[model samples]
Target: MRTHYRFGHEWQVQARPDAVRALLEDVAGYGAWWPGLRVLADASTPSRRAARLEVRAPLGYRIRFTLTESSVDRHELRALLRGDLEGWCMWRVVATRGGSRVVFAQEVEARSRLLRLASPLLHHRLAGQHAALLGAAADGMRRALADGEGAPGQRVGAP
Candidate 1:
């Protein structure tokens, strides 16, 4: 059995796109900010940056994936996700009146049979957990950017 998942999340960062991109590109430090996110490897460079990340929910299911950069744009970063999950994820950052608008979109399917089978009852919870994690990440980024790079902002979109 296979279960497909598509997620779209957007939030406001009280910083410039460059600051936000800098934080996002430094994937190795995700664990220091984003809870439960572990970066197994960081293959970032001055021109292109990406990483292999392990995502675990409180439900104890682990999804490991590598994000390989697939785009060459400055304001947008797209990645081909490969590993326990298969799909693509992207980050688009644009300047907003106050700061920057960050949009994150991901689509992937579960490779674990147990996870696929449990999706019917657990999808909502899983999405909620994902939302909370990103929300916290946004908060962390704001705090990190508080030193004149940015401030704090609110999270939009839904679970």
Candidate 2:
């Protein structure tokens, strides 16, 4: 049997689809807007990427995952999980009337028994965090599109 764990959030970004897609593809920019994500390793190139990340939620832990695949189709950018987590995290950008609708979805399997046992509780918290992170991303994208630089708000590094 296959076990499934998923969490996602949708937000309207005041930017074009291209702009939103650019920001999503730029993994290094994640630490600037995505809270609780401490970027341990940066994405080397536009094609292949990997990072050692310290995630605070779902029982504080660190995992180094390689971005096995990252590609854009029209407006959506898909990222496949490798190394630490076995799953997929996708970002969909749809053109709306005024801007772009962005959705962040992650479907991952528990890598350990502890993670599996805490799945129910962690799911709820992760859902909330995802929503918040998306909101922040939207704001950052808006600013970047307006100023020509994807400048994200200051974030303190993980201790």
Candidate 3:
């Protein structure tokens, strides 16, 4: 069974690249805009560039990982993950016709022995859940950007 998953989710928005980058870099602001999403600081992990974030989906499962290396620039926010999952995740922003295109890409391998072993049976379920989560995030961002307030708690965009 394959234990690694590569997910690429893309969307185009009327917002500019900088606007989208700002929203993506504000991980702490995610819960406010993204429905069923929660970002909590992981005090156990230390980082100067950004907070060590533990993200939880509405279903109560937490994505356990720490950013070992990361960088945020005008067009991209990329991070290398380590913990229960090991891999890299990136949010790439680029100018499009009238707005910007945002692509979220992640390549991760299950570090947990049990999860790795169960990949064959559980992979589809895992992918479906992540897709739903990403879809909600995209919808939330679209609303927040449309409202001109993408910051956390600025406006309720929960589904």
Candidate 4:
């Protein structure tokens, strides 16, 4: 029998909540800041509130996901997986005294029986990869903030 699991982590960045949100919305820059993954495609809706992104893992495994139900006021974003894996990935940003706290979580199930059987091993690897990627994002955000590279008028705290 296969089991489903949830993995999540929280990261603190020296950037305001709105700035962090904007940085995330910058699809083109994700590959620059994000550690391992590479963006394959970025399509935004007319409103630009929703987007579809195709990405590949560090090892070059491709995954396409759609981000929908975006709510900036709430500082949260949701994504549905469309390729390779089938599930949901979400990010919730909360404003903090100095900057912001970001929570990243994902719920996924294999699309095939073979993948399901391999989940135990893949889950462990994925968890580690996720942590590293989050760390990289945090580091990149910090560096970008230090250099004042984000949206204009948005000031980030000192590192």
Best by lDDT: 1
Candidate 2 shows a clash count of 0
lDDT digits (tens) for residues 17-94 of candidate 1: 777887776667777777768899886766666788898776677878877777847888788887877888888889
Candidate ranking under lDDT, highest first, comes to 1, 3, 4, 2
Question: lDDT: which is higher, 1 or 3?
Answer: 1
- Prediction 2 global C-alpha lDDT: 0.63
* Tens-digit per-residue lDDT, 1-159, candidate 3: 678899999997777676787787666566678876555563323553344555565456666666543776767888887776789989998888767788999999988676687677878877777798889888988887886443333333433
Model 2 pairs whose backbones collide: none
- Give per-residue lDDT, candidate 2, residue 74: 81
Lowest-scoring 10 consecutive residues by lDDT in candidate 3? 150-159
Which order, best to worst by TM-score? Answer: 1, 3, 4, 2
Instruction: Determine the backbone clash count of candidate 1.
Output: 0
Better of 3 and 4 by TM-score: 3
Give candidate 2's TM-score.
0.69
TM-score of each prediction: 0.81, 0.69, 0.77, 0.74
Model 1 — which ten-residue stretch has the worst lDDT? 150-159
The residue-by-residue lDDT of candidate 2 on 58-77, one tens digit each, is 34554456554466678677
Clashing residue pairs, candidate 4? none
Q: Residues 88-124, candidate 4: write the lDDT tens digits.
A: 7778888777678888888876664545666676777
Off by over 4 Å in 4: 1-3, 48-72, 112-117, 149-159
- lDDT at residue 141 of model 3 (Cα atoms): 84
